[model samples]
Target: MEPDRSTPRTSSRRGFLLTGGALASTLTETSMAQAATRARNTGDADAAPGSPQHPVVTRPADWQPVAERLDGVGRLGTDGLVYRATFPRYDLDLSSYGVSGLVEASYAAFARYPDGRTMLMGDVVATETELQRVTDAVQAHGLEQCAIHKHLLAHRPALWWTHIRGVSTDPVALAVAMRAGLDATATPGPRDPDTAPPAGLDTAAIDAALGAKGVSLDGYRFSFARAETISDDDCVVPPAMGVTTSFTFRSVGHGSAAVSGDFVMTAGEVQQVVKTLRHGGIDVVELHNHALSDNPRLFYLHLWAIGPAVSLARTLRTANAATNLGVVTPDANSSMSTES
Candidate 1:
């Protein structure tokens, strides 16, 4: 008989985990014993594909220690599943095309599994000179770099974005490894949140054009999760872990805005999404994958376009119609389990 699909697997037991080509040196013998106990209890020697496990609902207080470890402030999503910390690249003055309002920031998102493992996923924005050092630091600490590419079309002060991933029973350890990578760059420390939306941009009109509502960050932003189950190493990967389609709009001038974000796509949907965006006159920045062992093999296409805010949103809506995007929810994870 197969192991019960409901049995939760430990973080240290994934046979396909890719952490710089080896398991983190910090995973202890105790973790190994725990994995063995779980396997014995379930009567399964190998991990079996099953329903993606839901992320545990986490409160801000639950992640206070993690924030301390990262030496930055974090905000829990409205859904209470993923806690995210942002490190904007205020140190770098960048520009693409003639648009000077380049949205440059690094982020690390943490999600808790039902089995008590914390998974880390986010991207680091690094200058060309700082890329290798950042990679070396993360690799030395047992974290994995899922993907590396650019988010701008033709930018000065050349930059690279590297997606990082790690899973550990000790969330602080994951924070430490992530911090090591950030330390390699000149990313600034925490600052006040930009509560006000960009001036002269009508977000309501944007919502009407895109057929979805958006929230105000430094600029206006929107996120949509893929309709199908997304799994990595046979474990469910939540939308909050940098897996969703995202768009961030910042006012350029004269009621125009600069939009930058990525669309999460599968192999069959790739060409159509790209063609659709190009047909709408949007600039496709880069195409790549964000995870190594994800089922269905996801693809991420970064995009940039400067136009009237509503027009850009409508063009994005046309591109979105090409994928399997579901309803728009605020930090949505409703299908997954949430703690009371």
Candidate 2:
């Protein structure tokens, strides 16, 4: 009887192994078949990201009309996912800490998804008097008013930044809605050719200090994207869609520069960045949300500082290192269109 019991126990063990193996094999086969089907359906044979499931990148010609609709020149961001146009508040004689135009700009960005829908993200700069009208106009056209906040601690003419979001199958219609909001404010038209002089700061040292190349647009500018994916409403949000940590340095003269921009931070990194920047003598202007339903919940801390160009760069570098960031690389597919 004992011998028979042991034999049964051994047979049971063998059967379990056989069933487990067969089940695993079946699962593998099913998974492989499903993957193959998906690959075929998506034409993503290599399963590369930013494939057909991601935003539909547009050519310059495709976005020219959008630019015209905004009555502004648009630039296809370096990532090729977002087309962006800026509205510098040139009409406002704004000044903050002896600097004008330090943070006096608004922008509209359009991203096209594979589903043939377009999303708009913009920050419309308005005066205290114009804010209500701007909000009314944006809501009148069915755009979502995501956030309202300030980018400076104290400034003349009292400006407000309104973050806007909208989705439409008709992108030109979306632009018209955005244009309606802009019309409610005194924000100027398309940018003029940048006739400003070269930033009189030490460029090489600034680059080395920040570990990123600077572009001479409006000011000596540096843009850094986060290392991780950020999304809104389950769709990936590109960095150029007003999510990048931006720093603009304008020479205040005698090797010193006035620096102002925002740091895009996660919840946990906010205090650290603030402490680091304050410890470096940078004034933390405002802390606020830029979107309604962004995953990981981003907080933007607008900052201001005036110091030696390299010293300020080093301070910003330290603050930047307080968060997760990816290295910048120039891509060949990137092109900026100035169509208006």
Candidate 3:
């Protein structure tokens, strides 16, 4: 996969989780999760404008150690000093209809904060039945469930997607917590890496259209993230957390594709983005907020289209540029990749 330098934008398992807590009876699971988040963030009163400064606690996550903890293989991306583990749901049937490997759960970009603390962020895709239990595990482990929504329209199994976020001086502890959440579902462990099949779409044309880099999945799918570091509650939030404008291209044949995925945007950037999509003859499937109180209040738009891959990529790039990419100053120390 090659990198596309265009202007910007930018899950697993199954297990039964037993949760324990003493609390008032009025709070629902979602509210309780929000409360847990607030309690975790209570210390950030006088935060600075950009990246966070925290006391060094432990070393960053080791490759084999983290892999062993999560029952998967962790690969490091030198581009952003990020290590990620991907757990795919082979149990799902989207592939039966030729959608082909669209259901993947991944935790990416585990890195050390400047102060020596560790931060990690990821997206975990689960179904309706599995969503609550997964969120419970995340909250029980003190990890934050920042956003919850869908990526496709009217797919069977009624899937829902959620973004996971956490920070600690102890990277191992973070992995343990992440593993706890993964265990709450039927998410499987490491598997043999599949060979890349031809994606069939003109990938070079897509790169040119979006002006960003994305990876081709066995010739079935193409995905990219326009990365950005975010700040909301007076702290420098890591970009890998849930702050990317992501696009996924599914090949449908004859140089056309079925476009599905979402864009991460600030509240101020939403309307014009929708306009841009409509201008390109694309349909805005759903527009909604992903998180409750993230620093910049992220809004996501799930979009769909059917056309030449390059044509859709160019249209998506326009919509992507409407977000906070070029408008925001990235953390001075951040090595994030973005174009817009």
The order of the candidates by TM-score, greatest first, is 1, 2, 3
Report the number of the highest-TM-score candidate. Answer: 1
lDDT of 2: 0.68
Q: Model 2: how large is the Cα RMSD against the reference?
A: 15.6
lDDT of candidate 1 over 1-340, digit per residue (tens):
1111232444322211112211222222356654453343234223354545555555576777778877856777765567777777777777888867455778888876655567777778899999999999987777778778887788988999888877766677777777888999999887654658788899899999988988776668888888987777645676766678888888887878888888999999999999988987789988888777777689989898888889889899998999999877566322110100
- Each prediction's RMSD over C-alphas, in Å, is 8.9, 15.6, 12.6
| Most accurate candidate by lDDT | 1
lDDT of 3 by residue, 64-131 (tens): 46666777556654322345566666567654234555544545445543433445566576778988
Candidate 1 similarity to native, TM-score:
0.81
Winner on TM-score (1 vs 2): 1
Lowest summed lDDT across 10 adjacent residues in model 2 is found at 10-19
Report model 3's TM-score to 2 decimal places: 0.70
- Each prediction's whole-model lDDT (CA): 0.71, 0.68, 0.55
Q: lDDT tens string, model 2, 48-139?
A: 64333345444455676677888756777543467787777778777887787653677777776554556788878889999999999987
Cα lDDT for residue 229, candidate 3 = 47
- Candidate 2's error at 286, in angstroms? 0.8
RMSD to native, candidate 3:
12.6
Ranking 1 against 3 by TM-score, winner: 1
